[model samples]
Target: KEGRKLEQTARLIQKTAEAKNMPATKRAALNMQKLGRRMAQGRMDKKQAMVRMAQLTKQMQAQQRQLAQQAGQAALGGGKSLSQAGQQLAAALQSQAAGGQNAQGASKMQGAHSAGSKSTGEKSGANGGNKPAGQNAGHGFNVPGRNKPGDKPPQNALHGAAQPTPEMKQIAQALQQNNAQTLSEQLRQLARKAETGQMTPQQQQQAAQDLQKLADALQGTGMPETQQHAQAAAQAMAHGDKQTAAAEMRKAADAAEREAQQQQDAQGMQDAQNSLQDSQGEMAGAQDPGDIPDGPSGQGQGQKPGGKGQGQTGPPEYGGEGNGGRGGGRGKPNTTYHKGQKPSHKIRQKPGYGADAPHWLDPHFDPAKNPRYAKLYFGKPRTAGPSQAGPTRKTRPGEDTGPVRSTVPYYNSVVSARKTAENAMDREDIPPAYKKNVADYFNSLQPQSPPPPASSGAGGTKP
Candidate 1:
């Protein structure tokens, strides 16, 4: 039976070999080698546990060492350098393109970040959906005479390739439908329009760029006219540059600088106001003069030199206190005895001389003029009325009058005088003997004249 089994196995193996290619058996041998390798690595519970424990211990030690180093660095108080990410963020904010502000500030933070503005690149990243300034060239986006994909004419393209733009298809269709006459008429219209200067400045720029793109697109699209038009447009656009862009930028910068300068001036004015407020406060706290501190100096203001306080009282002024002028209360003038107190004896009536002015009013009217009449007037009083002659007097005619004043003495009173004279002599007015001698002598002198001479003078007058 064994022999029969072996023969069957050999027969089955031969049949399998005949049905397949020889390479399939080589692959079978490779598969048998792979199965032997898989069976050789058997699972072991105890040995695997020991290896896992060792690995766990080693990993724990390494982690502990790393933690210890970190702790030591923290305790040493070392300042840390900024991370690469933070540094890059700061650098981006400080870039030249970001003239006004830096990167982080583009988001508009408060406090420290608010002080510096954000960069242009950062702003572009922030608001690129809008027309950001960073990517703008002087003119239109596409350069002149440049090829544009998906913008070529369909007729000029390879078969089964992308279709052409609407403008390109329109132009191509027009060209296909035109003869020389129609094309010439269209060309003439275009020439007239160009000569009339129909385009605005912006439209001209866009048109030039579009023509260049069309020329490049038509080069392989079987259109020679488009190529010429593109070349002309590109050259004209190149020469049309006037540096207007740079002048606009400079003008903007100058305006910004002026605004900043005005801000600084406003800040300076505010500071000056603050300083003035401080000075006012100082003055407000100051004490008045004469309210001096300890030794007669005003508080804070100090003492003036020579026993005076700064801003102190002035000198005792005239016409003040006890020194009032005329009509002053309780202050009197010196007593002076004036001359007009006495009366005068002499009087003259004249116009406007009411009582006469005063004794002191006139220069000559002095009470002390004469020492004796110091209290009296110098002249007599005036008569009350006109003068009258006394009663008329009669004289005896031719009565032996020699000189009217004195030829002989009057005798009628002589006897009466003799008696009185004798009596006055008897009273010793003259001594008695001297009086008798005077009488005897006068009686003797009366008898001594020449009587013949008197007779002779009378006889001559009679003859």
Candidate 2:
């Protein structure tokens, strides 16, 4: 029983190495390698090895299903094929297996295995031989054109595989049927799934790309509503607002349905035209009358029937018979004041005629044109008084006045001299004499009157 179990494990490993499902085959190959190590190291007995092998078999089976599903998804998503993925996985597994043994021996074995596998794959492709063990090459399912069990994956096939989603399947079906309404509905559901964060980012991106393709197809078929929904879905995915995109898709579906119904009903078409005409008439009527220009005779074109100046009687022109004078229908003159009433005689000069007029007020006044007045008017104006009046006498600091009089000039002069002396003293280079002069000047500026004597008492005056 132990020998039989060992043989079975070897067979399973060989079959896994040849499997067409790349992910599953790789997983199985890895487990087989680990099992071989355990057996060689004497770590697992017969019963234990059998149990582990059974576990591995079950795991491989599940993985196979997963890998198949992934391949289908890849085809639907417009990516790599199942056979290409499997070939890549086989190569990786062989490399791993080779690394486990003695270097020289492993290299020899790996070369043999690669050559044999290549020949076998070629034979199957050219002669239509029986499908290899543990491979799904000859299955009846529809696959991408380039996909075949023995075919190698593209150089850029290193990216992880994407699993199929319900939304993706529905979209594929809708596309196959070429039904715009159905496609719109499926896209809406996909957008909703993306909005709820149920789908992975990669899946969302793929869905968005597919939607764009569908939109293009629909656009070519004269289904703008459906195309719009798909475009909106793509945009929503880009902005991460899947819910809004879904809503837009739903609206597109509804619009398509409505359009179909409208095509089938002739009365609906007539009603729509009538409604459009009514709306246009209302818009024209709502326009402001003042916006329209009056004709030469002061009558506006396109005016309503009952508007002013239509048929109502009014005063005739100057030559009509109603009035005696040339003026039509004589009435009180339209004047604020009587003919003899004159305004005030206060003559006012024009704006630019004043002496204080700004230079810019005279358009012809350019400094370059007339340089004579440039210094007088364009440059700073002359001071109001003479530039240099009589020389101001400089009095000596701290000089005493003859008397103290309660007059403005006397007080002003004294205050001014004191301030001048104080300012001179503040200068760093001034001598101490200047400070002394300021102090003396301040004392002289004080009033000369003595203080009044205090009263003897409140009730007994001089007594």
lDDT against the true structure, each candidate: 0.30, 0.40
Best candidate per TM-score, number? 2
Distance from true position, residue 305, model 2, in Å? 49
Residue 91 lDDT (model 2): 44
Residues 1-463 of candidate 2 have per-residue lDDT tens digits of: 2333343455454454454233334344555556656765678754576566556656644553443343232312233322333244334334433443344354445446644676565655565433343133222121222245676433211111122345545554554443435645665676567667886555565556555544544443334455577678667765767677667667766754543232222222222223323333443455322121111111111112222211111111101110011111111111122234332111111111111112222334332464543332222322223212111122233344344222233344656666665675675223342244347436745533433565877764431
lDDT of 1 at 331: 16
Using Cα atoms with residue i matched to residue i, what is each candidate's TM-score against the true structure? 0.16, 0.23
lDDT of 1 by residue, 59-110 (tens): 4344334422432221122222112212332343233224323422432343
Q: How close to the true structure is residue 248 of candidate 1, measured as C-alpha lDDT?
A: 27
